[model samples]
Target: MQYLVLAVLVGCVALLLAVLALRFGWRLRWLLGWLKGNVLLALLAAAVMLGLAAWDLQNFTEIEPRAATVGTLSFNKVGNQQYEAVLTGPQGNETVRIAGDLWELEVEVLRWHGLPGALGLVDGYRLHRLLGRYLALEQQHDSSANGRELLPNLHSTPPWRDLWAWIDNIEAHRLLEADAFEVRFIPLTDGAQFSLELGPTGLTPVPLNPAATAAMKRFN
Candidate 1:
């Protein structure tokens, strides 16, 4: 949409300049030639800029989760100290592995707000980060869980990757904190109907309701 407006603006300005040059006669002949060349160069530059902008929009914008499910989490002890949580939702099942005694689960809700969101510009959530406890509170094993794993690679070849990182950097400052875990949209086939919220005391399981399961069918 921005690109469309820019192109229209540039075209109108170029047309106006062309009309002025033709009306001014031989005195502006050299200026007309220069303007033509410069306009072509400007158009090429604008094309590149528009392409980059489109890519950035596609990669950096966040849309509402297409499918949000609320599920019940069941924990089962496995091995000596390790544990496995089976998240059974209406759509499907997901397994979350917890390696430490002290662990935290972070669920983030990202939305495109203001003018950008109104324009229907959207982005998406990472499925693993939304449901999996990939990071531990402390480093205990050789394969330490780094929060950086959740972030997209800055060195990635995609031109839009930097834009994505920049947008995330902005959102990082506005993270939401909750006392009673607020509702979050889980992107899964058979996900939980309600939102997942984490606090200092850890997650408290919510019993599955047949009514909620029926309502969550709308997301599917």
Candidate 2:
């Protein structure tokens, strides 16, 4: 929206300049040539602004601070300390075999505060990954519990290329802050089901079944 406004303002200024040059008739040919060049420049500027607006619209959602369910997960035990996990979310259902005592979900969040927040640049988040985790340090290091990628290359993708980092670098005042990463984890019990939520602060897991509730109780 801001980009659109800027584009319109640039076009209006260019039209006004052309009209003024013709009305004054000061070095008519020279001023006309200058206006021609500036007109081309103005067109290029408008095009760039429009492109940015379109990109922003496509990539971002209206930032909401309230908690929202982003996905759900269920587990079935397959072997010792191993489970077949099914995750259903915006991207769809994905199944991965994991070996661990707990399941962890990680997300990347972009937050805007103060003037930017007031201007409607609120918050945006991307699912980072889902991984198996161990409570013990030795098990975490030695166990074969490699996690699965929930969302592919979220940080490196074009147009999204770490937008938070770019904003932090360019903005003199700290109006935006990206959480290095937010994580939520729960015990991985057989037949356990949970709904994952993305809130203003971070990710949270809500148990959905008796198995899940019991697992959480033991974990807590």
lDDT of 1 by residue, 1-220 (tens): 9999999999999999988878887487788899999999999998987676456444221323443333455445575545565654333566665544332333322344566556865533222222222223444433354542233221222534333444555634333211122233322222233343233333333335543354345423
Per-residue lDDT tens digits of candidate 2, residues 44-135? 99897667545543443333568888889899999988898888766567777876788777666667778898997767765556677778
Which run of 10 residues does model 1 get worst, by summed lDDT?
175-184
Q: Which candidate achieves the best lDDT against the true structure?
A: 2
Which portions of model 1 show Cα errors greater than 4 Å? 1-69, 88-92, 116-166, 171-220
Q: Tell me, what's the RMSD of every candidate?
A: 14.7, 12.4
Per-candidate total of colliding backbone pairs: 16, 0
Report, for every candidate in turn, its global Cα lDDT versus the true structure: 0.44, 0.71
